[model samples]
Target: MISVTEAKQIIRANIRALPSSLVNLADAGNSVLAENIYAAVDIPAFDQSNVDGYAIRFSEKDITLDIDGEITAGSEIIKSLSKKKAIRIFTGAPAPEGADTIVMQENTAAANNTLTINDPALSKGMNLRPRGTDIRKDELALEEGTLLTPAAIGYLAAVGSAKVNIYRPPALTLIITGNELAQPGLPLRTGQVYDSGSFALKSALQLHGIRSPEILHCQDDPHELTLALRHALSESDMVILTGGVSVGEYDFVSQAAENCGVTKLFHRVKQRPGKPLYFGMKDDKPIFGLPGNPSSILTCMYVYVSLALNMYLHKKESLYQPAILKNAYRKTAGLTHFMKGMYNAGYVEILTGQESYRMSSFAKSNCLVILPETETEFKPGYQTQVHLL
Candidate 1:
């Protein structure tokens, strides 16, 4: 059996980032940039006013003069502010020629179209927004590989980019295998349980910004599993299967995938609850056979599948962090273990009853306490790795 780290490396090596496409700025949120975005023109474009005030030359202080003209946004002023004269300007309006300062209307007394400055503390460049002060022409405003947040989208729009090059989201498929499973809302007969792993896995994917996976549920029949595998391989970039992966009589997913041209990379790992995990590839598409147990499925998804998908999308793959255990944890470690735990207030506490099928512990857990392959028990204050859910 392979270690968890080894399994992760193998899984990541098979995936690749999606190709780039041109998308509108409004639709580029949360997507990764594929190209560096340079400013097409200087921000602010020209000298403008930052406040609704009177534009004046710095040399003019005591002279009462006529207002040359009024300048609003998107309009130009043909007249220049001569010595001892001012121009009435609004916010965002271009500063009149030869004007280097603006006295806010609140600081001046005006009557009968005549204005008198009440404050003499105004300095040159006051309330005047210089051209390219916020951003310069030809400057690289957004770098490649930047994740486009809402702020980023607004920035791109400000820089006059209507469309941006972004990496496309990968197409994903979910295949659930098990004959004893029944859909929710159906009356369960004896020896049958409602299939919850499919919904759980799908919802988890949705939380990570993936919402359009092709989901397929197949019974524990070889023919049905083979057919589903074939369909998934052709259309999906990644296929995640739950159940029928363990070494049981009905475990035919692995064999079916291989028969349908999948090259099995690893079929099991040295971990608790998820030891029967499998990963493979078919026609360059990655496939994951997660453990049937609900908790194990979730753990594997967060640890292995999430990393794989990020690597495929050319994103940073370091989401898990090492944390100090708040209390001691007992284990005879040969295989790596990932136990459900709660991380809070700078401490982590492992939940009890980590059995593969029993998901009660996972309900109260928010993290997975990762234990490396070692033969030792951890005491309080011991540092261990944790994968945040």
Candidate 2:
């Protein structure tokens, strides 16, 4: 068994990033950029009106002017304003040639073919979006390693980028190993339990921009589990096995993985709920054999698994957020405890249930409070570390 820090270090040292791929903007969801993006063309492309009103030369604002034909958004034609004239224009319509300002329709009165400027406070360039004002052509838009958020994707689209280069997330396969597990919504036989790890693991993977990883289920038989491991290694860049990693007589994940030619990096970690976690590698691919308990699998995913995935994308993030303890807590010595807890702005309170099989408190908690193995006594107002869910 190894400490949590050592487990993380070993996992990181064994994995490497997958190659970057050019993906369509539509498919890029909160992914990290592999390359710097530059604006392909000026935003707005032309001076355009931001309001529904009139486009006019600023010098002509003080006098009544004749209204020319209107300009609507997406129109291919541009009209030039004659001296002492204004053109009716709507939002997103290009400013007519020889025009420098837009007057809001709400601020002016118009009748017949002429217009009258209303109350003051109008200035030059008012309501007019200048060409290239948002981003000039060929300017750096987003740097490499930036997260492709919704706004970032929209901004890239504005600059005419249909696709981008992003460090690829792995193709993952999940191998569920158990004979006593029954699918949800089905009648359970005696000594059987409903499987929760599959749903929890899939949802957590989705949060990292990974969707719909292939799932394979097998019984505890040695041959069947080995075949599952072999198939997962063949089809996926990473494999996660839930259940059957412990020393139980029925547990066969470790043996099956070894039979499938997977080199074991470590078999246990010195943490609560997930102590029997197994990590291994085959060639360049990484494999994780997580404890069967619902809470343990999720916690291991957040800590050990996240480190490996981020390393595969050339990304780094802090693992803990500091908070002040709201209540004193005590625990047995010799094992580090990752207790489910509630975290607010700057404070945290450990909840009641911390058992591996119980998820009631896990459901209510937003973080995993870290209690060191050496420190057994915690007092209120003491500084603590938490991993936010």
Candidate 3:
């Protein structure tokens, strides 16, 4: 058995990042950039008007001027202005050839063909958006490895990027093994329980941007488990198996992994809820054998599987932050405890039902309060490490 930190380090060292691919700009949200993006042309390529008023040369102030031709947004019409003359322009319209300033319509009074500045605070170049002000041509727009946010997507679209190179999300295969498991909506037989692990794992994976994952079920027989494991290893970049990892007679995950030529990095960890967690690798593909208990499987996914996927996508790993405990709790000084917790207004409260088999309390929680293995007792109001869900 190894500590939690050591197990995570071993998994990280064994896995490799996925390759990059060109994705359509419309579908690039939440993806990491594989290459730096440079501006092909200046944003607002031409001098633009920011208000629906007048574009003047700004040689003189506080004077009436003749109204030149009007320019609406997206119009290709270009006109030059003479001295003491202004052009009627709408927002986003290109400035006239000789205009260098804009006075907003709210700040000026217009009559028939003449305009006068009504506000005394009007200055030269006021309300005018110069060309290349937002971004210059051939300049770096977005650097490599930047996570594409909604605003980032809009900016890319504005710069005419139809497609971008990004690290693709890894395809996964989830193999659920246990003879005592039955699917939901089915009547349970003697010594059988509903399979909540698959549902919970699938929902949790979807939340992390994995829309579709191949899932397979198998009985406790070693031959059946080995076949399923081999097939999944061939199909996916990573494989996650639930149940059959302990040392019981029905447990066969370790044997199946060995039969499939996977090197076991670690078999157990000094952690509560998921102490029987197994991590292995076949070449560059990782295999995670998680415990069958509902809360245990979910906890292991959040702590281990999520980290591996983040690394493959070149995303920043999750961090632990300090939160004030609302109550006191006690545990033996052997294994690290990941208690279901609700975080609100900078304080975290450990919820009830901390057992591996119960998931109701976890469903109501938004974080996991991490208690180190060396601490046996916790007092109220003590600062503790928390990982937000």
**TM-score of each model, in listed order:** 0.89, 0.97, 0.94
Q: lDDT-based ranking, best first? A: 2, 3, 1
Report every candidate's CA lDDT. Answer: 0.84, 0.91, 0.90
lDDT of 1 by residue, 1-389 (tens): 89877887787677767778898888777778999999988998889889998998766756676676688887854457777677899999888789888889899877767778867788889998999998998999999999888899998888899999887766888999887899999999999998888888898887555788998989899899999989988888888999989899999988898889999999999888689998998867888999898888988888888887676545776467778898887888688888899988667898888887777888888888887778568888988878787
| Count of clashes, each model | 0, 0, 0
Give the residue spans of candidate 1 off by over 4 A.
61-70, 74-83, 118-121, 182-192, 358-364
lDDT of 1: 0.84
lDDT, candidate 3, 1-389, per-residue tens = 89999998997887787889898999888988999998988998889999888898777557888887799999987778888888899999999887888988888788989988876777788888889999998899999999999999999988778999998878899999888899889999999999998999999888666889999999999999999999998899999999999999999999999999999999999999899999999999999999989999999999999899889888887767799999999999989999999998889999999999998999999999999988998998988989898
Backbone clash total for model 1 is 0
In angstroms, how far off is 10's CA in candidate 2? 0.8
TM-score of 2: 0.97
Q: lDDT, candidate 2, residue 371?
A: 93
Candidate 1: residue pairs that collide: none
Sort all candidates by TM-score, best to worst: 2, 3, 1
- lDDT digits (tens) for residues 223-303 of candidate 2: 999998899899999999999999999999999988999999999888897999999999999999999999999899988
For model 3, the run of ten residues with the poorest summed lDDT: 56-65
Question: Candidate 1: minimum summed lDDT over ten consecutive residues — where?
Answer: 310-319
